[model samples]
Target: MRWTALYARSRHLTVALAAVLLCAAVLPLLLGDSWSTVFATVTLGAAVAVAGVGLSGQDLDLDRTASFRWPPRRLTHLLVIGVVAGGVMLAAQGLADLPIDSSWILRDVAGLLGLTGLAATLFGGQFGWTLPMGWAMTAALVPKAVGQAYDVVAWPMATADSAQAWWVAGLLFVAGTAAYTMAGAHR
Candidate 1:
């Protein structure tokens, strides 16, 4: 009885997280550019949450399937979700009129890395592959996020510098890939 109650609670939490992700993805279309980037960031962040929830759910399911379930499928599913979610978020952000320079892209990439890490942690926990990936991805995103936040909120409002930002973003991309590769090495 206690176990069943816990299962129900987890299921409810999953539904709630999914709802939040949907709202995050839709905010940009609902309002104008003034709030678009922030909305997008929130939505992407929520997406990370959703992915984490999914990974946890998957992990729990595998516990039940310990008799025969494989881990590769869960990992693959996570990768696909990351790719699709990132693509949609990027396309939506691009459609908006917010600064499309390098810094903006860096922030987006950082957010994407964070989301990927969250997803991996949720789904790949059983295999001991997600922690490092999640940690590295989170690390890569923080600097860019900080820079973007400073430009947007601090005094002397700095302008977006695409070139330098893009370079940073590119470096992050390479680092993220290496982390991912290391995470999946055993698989």
Candidate 2:
């Protein structure tokens, strides 16, 4: 119990949770009865971006010095971030009576979380938010079209039924999870 609390504090989990909740709650209210795909994508991006800060601890050296194995912990942390962000968004959408599908939210959250993990592994935990936000921005700015290539590039904003988007998101989730689990975050 004590150890769990200490771990949460060290990783700033409370702050991340609060920020995720806030983003989730606010976005639905702001959109009101007009929910767009782009808005949903941006909302998920904001939630992941704020929560991703805890992907690494305060000191990489200190984390390395710890006695316990890290891979499992890292994997669990990433999964928890996905669940929290996705769950909050789903709940908010439900409250707003929006018609967003669960599969779409799940896909976006998975891919975004994967990007967060990949960023943490490549650029350190502090930078974990960059890849997701950057990708989301790109997805938002790109003109919508109908094509496999476009679906891959805009996977974050792709419709739930897009096969290309699902494949891309799945690949990203697997690769990012594996990399982050094995390498942890960069110093």
Candidate 3:
């Protein structure tokens, strides 16, 4: 599949996968839940950063020329970008021995997709990781943002008690996807 082709050539994807693997092996065993959160933030922070893999001026033109699945190349590629990052989240969770709450972590993944997509659209993939990573680090280390903004900010931080978090995360995912697709379409 064309998605496979894109993934094979993506340095961002490569690094993201490697990071998830390393964190899975080391973080849970070495530290407590605090470090696990740190890992979660960092890994999900990769949302947009991973999109950087095949994104460039040249890559845009290439995508325009190549037709993948039913969706436009841009849409499919971005979808794959999100999906791969989400998979990394799942792997990290399983390895870390976190509870099997799909909605909780999935909301995080969806929110990340949105953040990463938004970052990639606004800033370009060159600095895709900057905003999300900054947000993640702040959320993890600062404590203030994480507690208050978990639901407000969206992402995995949203507690399990609220169904609203799922809606917010889905909104983020759609918004981010639209932004990315529109940006590429216009350019």
Candidate 4:
């Protein structure tokens, strides 16, 4: 079917499965108060980005030359996927014990979506998830890595000063939009 190709190439399901599996495996320990706030938001954000990486800059030259395309442009693709990932994650909160604040979910969606977009634009979609996810993991594992010199890094905001997470998320989105939209037309 015409739609099958569209759905097939996109990696939304991959991201979703990865997110569910991660939650399944880690949710137990993250339950109660600890899992309901910024901590949970940060973890889910990275997982969601892993799947979103596939949608970034896929077969660009081929798409330009093809009769059909996955997305009209990289920016549109990222925006749609980012919003979808955010909505999905927001819905997920309803079923589980996540933060009561919608801001947390919004923050996660923005950060992960932007990070993935930027990574895919810079590193290629196949391995785009590496930087964002890696940085998030590092921040969660080693808070000292990001440093206060760059609070916009975000993941550290999970435990550091969460008030700034919104700014961090916005920065990632803006930078990622620039990267993906203005990316070199090599591919």
Candidate 5:
């Protein structure tokens, strides 16, 4: 078997990918005409949360002992999660003729993937879904108040063009990516 296939199997990537694809494909269709930024945020968050489970392998010590470098692999894993989640959602929305903006999907996927990475780094890979799901739920529930504070707090649900939302998402993406790449999921 190929090294890539072995790595993917060890990380349960197939299960995570299936779950992400399912969420991305089904959520928007269920929402139908009522789809909006909030639903999009939730859908993306769920997809990322599901895929993030594979951020770390079953045995951290064994993984660390591997001869190959880990940083690049970790970075690629995160990027792939974002790409797959975002790409599936975009395709689903396009097929259904939903009104979700591509920009919003991009921003939310990046931010949510970052949050998952951060969660994995801090709480271990098994718990990586917590941060993204928690933030998405909070954003969906919070009232839409005006101002930078609200935008930052509810970045996931913010409009596609909101400057504050973009900044927060970008910062999270950079910080989470850097931290996770430098330090694989917490032992």
Candidate 6:
């Protein structure tokens, strides 16, 4: 029983950490080639990280009969958090004299929602979710690492969307959630 409880706790922690690492890894790619895009990615990443922190921190609070007072309130809280994150980022950009504008906040919100949709699909266990999530993470991380390695091995080559990269990322995300679900059952 003790070991089982320990495993559960550890698994939850692992998921939260994975969430952080995944977002951090993807932030660079999601930034693409625009200052606004970079700011938006960073902002959304921060918001998601914050949400993960909140959810993970309250893992034990699952016992609460009312985890949320109401569904709309839950949405409200998320929006409030997003606003705070965007406002904070904007303030920092202003102080630093970065060319970032507040208009990017809307884009950031949309990107954050897209990421959340992907994450939710992974968590909700539809179609081989487990393997894909893990694979997606690995796929995302491997390219950046390879880029660094190639710079050392050969002349720096500009990265482009490769066929293998797309397949790996897509497959991993779709299958990883399934893998996660299977792993959850074993625990």
User: What local distance difference test score does each model get?
Assistant: 0.44, 0.88, 0.58, 0.59, 0.90, 0.37
Please report the TM-score between candidate 5 and the true structure.
0.96
Best by lDDT: 5
Candidate 2 ranges beyond 4 A from true positions: none
Per-residue alpha-carbon lDDT of candidate 6 for residues 1-108, written as tens digits (9 for 90 to 100): 664354336335455444444443344334445544334444345544433333212232342344334334324433443455555555555544454445544433
- The sequence of per-residue lDDT tens digits that candidate 3 reaches over residues 19-62 is 54454334444554655455655656654454543443435566
Q: Candidate 4 versus the native: TM-score?
A: 0.68
Q: Largest TM-score belongs to which candidate? A: 5
Candidate 2 weakest lDDT stretch, 10 residues: 141-150
- Any runs in candidate 5 off by more than 4 Å, and if so which? none
Q: Is candidate 1 or candidate 4 better by TM-score?
A: 4
- What TM-score would each prediction reach against the true structure? 0.45, 0.96, 0.68, 0.68, 0.96, 0.40
Evaluate residue 1 in candidate 3 and report its C-alpha lDDT on the 0 to 100 scale: 77
Provide the lDDT at 4 for model 1: 40
Q: Model 1 segments beyond 4 Å from truth?
A: 1-21, 58-69, 91-187
The residue-by-residue lDDT of candidate 2 on 1-187, one tens digit each, is 7767878998899999999998877877888978788888888998997888789988889888888899999999999999999999999888898878899999999899889999999999999999888898899887776566779999988889999999999998898888899999998
Q: Candidate 2 local accuracy as lDDT?
A: 0.88
Residue runs of model 3 more than 4 Å from their true location after superposition? 1-35, 51-53, 57-71, 141-150, 185-187
Q: Where does candidate 2 clash, by residue pair? A: none
**Which structure is stronger by TM-score: 5 or 6?**
5
